[model samples]
Target: MNPASPIRIQGIHYTLPEKQVGLEQLSAEGRLLSTPETMRDFGFGDCRVSSVPATVLASATVKALLERHGVEPGEVGLLINASVLPTSSLVPRGEALAEFPSGESAHLGLFRFSSTRIQDELGLINARTVGLSELGCVSLSHAVWLAHAVMLMEDLKYAVCVNADVFPDGIKREVVYNVCSDSACAVLLSRNPEGMHLKRYHTLTRGYYWDPDGHQNELLAAYFPTGKRVLEKTFKESGLAREDIKLLVPHNVSLRSWEILSRFTGIPLEKIYTENIRPKGHSVAADNWINLKDVIDRGLVSKGDHVMMFSFGLGAHWGCSIVQV
Candidate 1:
């Protein structure tokens, strides 16, 4: 897994549904808290959605990837869904745990409603579903890492990684509104290099030190460190550093989170490629893939550009990948 090895990204597609939810509108719905103080603190403007169910975004994204790549759906060996909104209540405890700083009382109803819609619309079959719900902004990147791993182990010819979310309506809590948006992105992955090759990956996570008095450290411990550790190990195994990376894509949850991660990684803030947060706000799990597609579409990463991706969610789950153009 040499970082220098080239991985080609053949096709990337994303969907931003027509429906848009502004901060002002959410404020009216009592779902988004829009006090001046809160707005200044969180740096949230608005979010997006589709009139259709969240799962439709997933299906649409998958279809878009297939159409763009001119590949058939049956050719896909796996379908990995990285979403913040689950359509099914069957298994909500694992990755889809509900814990908001604003508490769950005000938001649970909306959550259940959207989750039901997601379950109803995404009657996806054939491909195994790797459900990642609560991972929030980092879900898509984690899916990408999983896609790469699957390519390494299985006889899979192609993998479809889909990320979609619809910021729940009737969310009366502003704290929950600003950073959440509705969007979907689909990426087609293959072992063959007729497209992009996945050269290497690095992930690192460290939490919960042995200390009796510092209970506050447990807060940071909420994030899963195993995936993060694997990312770092992969980087070391590949023998490369940030300097060799031409572009960096991170899960941009907020302005502050982006700044903190930039400081922690020592990657210049300017080198990071962020989505149109001011325009589209945060698209939850779809952020990473959408940003990757933006990079590809804007011609920001030319062929042979060394792109690095880092993503993590509340569980402190972190994943990183290095792909060569």
Candidate 2:
């Protein structure tokens, strides 16, 4: 039997506009979410939009992914946009070949690529969309798993996984105050060896609730675990113990969840990078790529290191994938 095609993360890039963060970057502007005055004072307006559109983010990330590995967009067999926000026409946008096209009005919609319409417009034959409403935080790794499955079961060569999510406007500061932030992440996944290859994939979900009366409760119930039993079941199912993971990127719901996971996994506090305290904040679905991007860009890992990822969404869903760098 032929072996599975090795899945590698070729290149990773992200854009966080400087002008985007108004008061959030200021020291004096800091305040707790419980205060309505602070919420009003801060410009946590409707979700943030990139200086570029959703497709721009996808295109830029794809371009970087290709250029870094000396590959071309045309060479990519599949393009998957797990982005919560897709272009208006829902068409493939990479065909434009330019980041910002000024005089291209009529062909604007043609270049946009929407994963939802991949199988219909193109003879993708097996293309499918994983909507953010259904995917939540686990979308990127889920796409990786699907692409791996396709490569193993089919004869596909390459797949591009793009994740772009913008926090919508009018979100109560108190709502996602601790754990949510705005950001975009894109990754090109393929069977190439220059990039880190996937060795195994594991997923676990444990039910968690914010109960004040239970003596271990605080914060609002922003999200719930998909299934109670599934959360603690990953350690044994993944075929490796928690100590085997050199790095872990989980959904950074809040400080409380971090503490809960640290206790549950028995991993060190320093190994977790999702507890972000900065202008970037906690990016939802983009957490995995963003964290991995930092690791790759900073030259933090060796060739044989293993990176474990955990993603949980609002649907009470959780996903985990182990990559060997």
Candidate 3:
């Protein structure tokens, strides 16, 4: 395999609102789509839900990230919004958006353009805005991939990768099996290596599950087989074997799925971090990175240790990123 990319994750920050809901609470409230027992079997737990929209959550974290690193908004070369469930934005963030009202004009359907909104709201005047949709939970890491490519191609310095999610009212927090949570995360990427070393990113998708909202059965059937193939390829491309990886940073999905996946990928279950499965549930795009920060903080992934982050989006996107700490 070739040498890995030199891009670095300068800083990663995520935010979850104060509101929390437990599985039992949801069960009692009759808001869970799946029965409490089934959800618990998959990996039931409580999660933080935000009252604000997803865009607001994303913008708040991005602003905080800029302040934490002492980076000016003008220094941001690209702002990539990678969110699956973007809550509706009632107000326009830009001057041009005023021309089109909510129900008038052909601008946006219902979901807002969070990239430009964040840019305009935060005065990221010089930063070009972009978004990655339909990738579901995979879009977050894919944003890293896109950022790496853009910076390398455009000779840019700093790229802001943002992800956020919000489930509407009356919607079930559990999908398929993994529980859902509202959260936002921001990752500052740079060509300069001063922080988390981003080694390689690999992704695979099955279009058969493109419209999986009504086709949950087929999506479930395709998860393991397709996910295993991509994960094997991800490990291969990173030049790391099963035993070479010290840890597998997983998205906050189901423990049962990871149990079966360990047998397929040959990575032991002990290496897979699952402590957050109950605490945060599946934090959509924030899961892998959140788990990553936690494990690194606890000395689970040490210096020079090889680690892999794996995630499967609802739209049948399976991918992983292999990093050397």
Candidate 4:
């Protein structure tokens, strides 16, 4: 198994919560830790709040993707789950996880076994499930990388990588300068030699800033230098130049942060897709892959496009992926 061999991106699908909650609404609902005006100052807007369990959304999206692509659950050899909430957020399709504060305390008991439950829900019985966490927002991109590695090393035929989560309370919504959205993204990777390829991936973690709040200033200070390093290193590994990238498919962070990163990395702002930020807010698990789906769905990339996806997690982890599509 050659390291450079292609692991085709077979499909990418995601599900957003049905109900949209405005920034002002959170304050009115008594869910915001800060004032509405304070949240709005960061470019926060309407983000989805699902009345249903996170697992229902994730499983439904995965099922539809498999069916539409004529893929069977049994054929999926690996299930790499990138969801890392503190509790089990999956519930009935129409029931809001946010409505249950009592059940949340019980989620801790079931948290370790969430991947098995998600596997059963999606009927991916043949899939050997693997969980990823502690990377915060970069977990999904790392899941994609793991999909590639597992397929190459273990000779797996297919992997379904899912990144999904929605907060049970509006109080859990905001992360620094970004508003968190509830959503899930499912991406399929197949052992194909000539499809969208995961060309290069680089992940780095600074454990010192593990406490995001205590080190807010430090996190802000290190962000630009760290992002530039990760992006450049990933590009170098992929045998591409930063300026040659077709697009910067970001993890739907704030536009201001994206602007800073664009100048720091020398990738034009126009090449970065930010249209989804307003409607999509930031889903820690789903951002990069969801943005990738939006880009491909909107016909923004050609077959040979060189795209870069980068993400930062609160636990001081930065991960980026360079792909050939």
Candidate 5:
């Protein structure tokens, strides 16, 4: 595999749960720690809630992507699960201690890997399964970068990166005033250069803000500056100027935050895709991919058009990736 050969995104698909919950309802149900007015001010209207397990949503997206692209199960050489939540946990962490006094259930939960389950269910017998976590919302970006590297090294045919996340029942849906939705997204990468071409990626991890809950204000303070630096570095690596970016595939955080970032980075706010912010809210690692897919579907971009993807994981990881459509 030549290093110069581009790894392309052959296809992308995402699935959200059928249930949609509004901010008012979430606050009324105590699922939100913030007031409904605050969330609305942040540009959040409604978010999808999942009635099924995270793995089920993940598998659904992958299955849909493969079927839509006519990709065979045996053709996928790598399966990467980038979901932030536990896929196979039989019980919540709080209940595990009480239900399994001997810790047998805990051990079983650890052994029940979500990646393998998706592989088995999808009959991806030739694919090697890997799970990535702790990067928070940046997990999917890292997973895609890993797949690109591994596929190049192993000379693999196809790699599938899947990410799904859902807040547990009775858990808070609001995180620092941003509402979250349950969603799963799958991106198919191949040597075939028919889709978006993978260009360059940059990631920065600030270990000092490792404790997200403890340092919420500090994390918010560092987001824009760190994100600007990341975007500049990513564009420099891609050999493209900021003006070359046709669109900014942003993570569904907040419209106001994106406006601030756009102003700071000298990228116009119109270049950032924000249509999904109010309707879909944020879906952790799946936001960028989902937005990218929609952008392409709407014919907002053309062949050879460059798009920049950026996200800040709550674990203090900042990532930026550039791709050409």
Candidate 6:
């Protein structure tokens, strides 16, 4: 994609659940597999727990993005749901595991499509809906790339990429030493060359590590090297050096891991935006987008500055994108 006419981010909006649970509370309730001390050492202070369903959060995010940017719902030409968890599996966090099997039949769950529901509820009549999964934390990055490609091919003017995920009831919030949170983010992409410009992006998936539980150790071993490779490729393709990147918008995972990655990629640790790590925790694919929005909102980067976003997904996926603001 040409940088001159790149896919621009018009607006970004993210919604977190009202309830905030501290690490100690989750540990006490047995909802977190790791100890509270371990999680706190890993840089997680608290995470948001959704009392409502994921679909409601997703819809509200998209609606807020449109309203904040003064864009009508009818003007959105593409809508991509990039949630890590399937819509069928995303029920209210407060619901019990046993009640889920009896409350909603398999048929009903199978037909619960978040993309279409958001479109219908938000009145995105002209938007083409698509749902993406399996990429795990990289799902939203893939959605952004897909939206950009589809818009260029179809001559669409506006595209909305929304991602939302919640841990099913009775499931542990700790994953590979990182705390998880329930949240949704919506990013509006336009062809009018405004906001952040999508300069270059790269993604890699290693199917050999598909079984997260079975290959947890191996996945952890490969995370840093694979993530470094993706970041290097993104910088190389964007024709910029690590020093040129004004900010590194990262997925809200372990701050220690990011510190190691910064050393591996030769990017200074101070360049990374880590303010959200403790407060927001990891909201799956929504982390990078949420952080990016906050970075822009706080004036962390000036116009024409290069920003790099990177994330490692549980399904053994590595994704990196360099954008110009």
The clash count of every prediction, one per candidate, is 24, 16, 1, 4, 0, 0
Give the Cα error of residue 16 in candidate 4, in Å: 0.9
- The local distance difference test score of each candidate is 0.60, 0.54, 0.81, 0.79, 0.85, 0.85
Query: What does candidate 1's lDDT look like per residue over 160-217, in tens digits?
Result: 7777765444543333324566677877777556666577655543344223136335
After superposition, the stretches of candidate 5 with alpha carbons farther than 4 Å from their true spots are 1-3, 87-103
Instruction: Encode model 5's per-residue lDDT on 99-165: one tens digit a residue.
Output: 2223656566566666898999999999999988888889898999999999988989999999988
State the lDDT of candidate 3 residue by residue for 149-225, as single tens digits.
88877978899998888776677777777788888889998766657777778888777787878787877777788
Write the number of the candidate with greater lDDT, choosing between 2 and 3.
Answer: 3
What would the per-residue lDDT of candidate 6 be over residues 1-325, giving only the tens digit for each residue? 6666656887789999978999989888788887899889888999999876777788998999999888999999999998787642334333532123335475565655778989999999999999888889998889998999998889888999999887776778888899999998988999666577888888899998899999988888888888888888887788889778899999999998988988887788899999899999999999999998899889998889988999889878988998888
TM-score of each: 0.74, 0.70, 0.91, 0.91, 0.94, 0.94
Off by over 4 Å in 1: 1-9, 33-42, 88-134, 172-178, 204-235
Candidate 4 structure, TM-score to reference:
0.91
The lDDT, on a scale of 0 to 1, for candidate 4 is: 0.79
Please report how far candidate 1 places residue 186 from its true position, in Å: 1.0
Winner of 1 and 2 under lDDT: 1
List pairs with backbone clashes in candidate 3. 304-325
User: Between which residue pairs do clashes occur in model 5?
Assistant: none
Native-to-model Cα distance after best TM-score fit, residue 272 in candidate 2, in Å: 1.3
- Per-residue lDDT of 320 in model 6: 90
Question: In terms of TM-score, how similar is model 6 to the real structure?
Answer: 0.94
Provide the global lDDT of candidate 3 against the true structure. Answer: 0.81
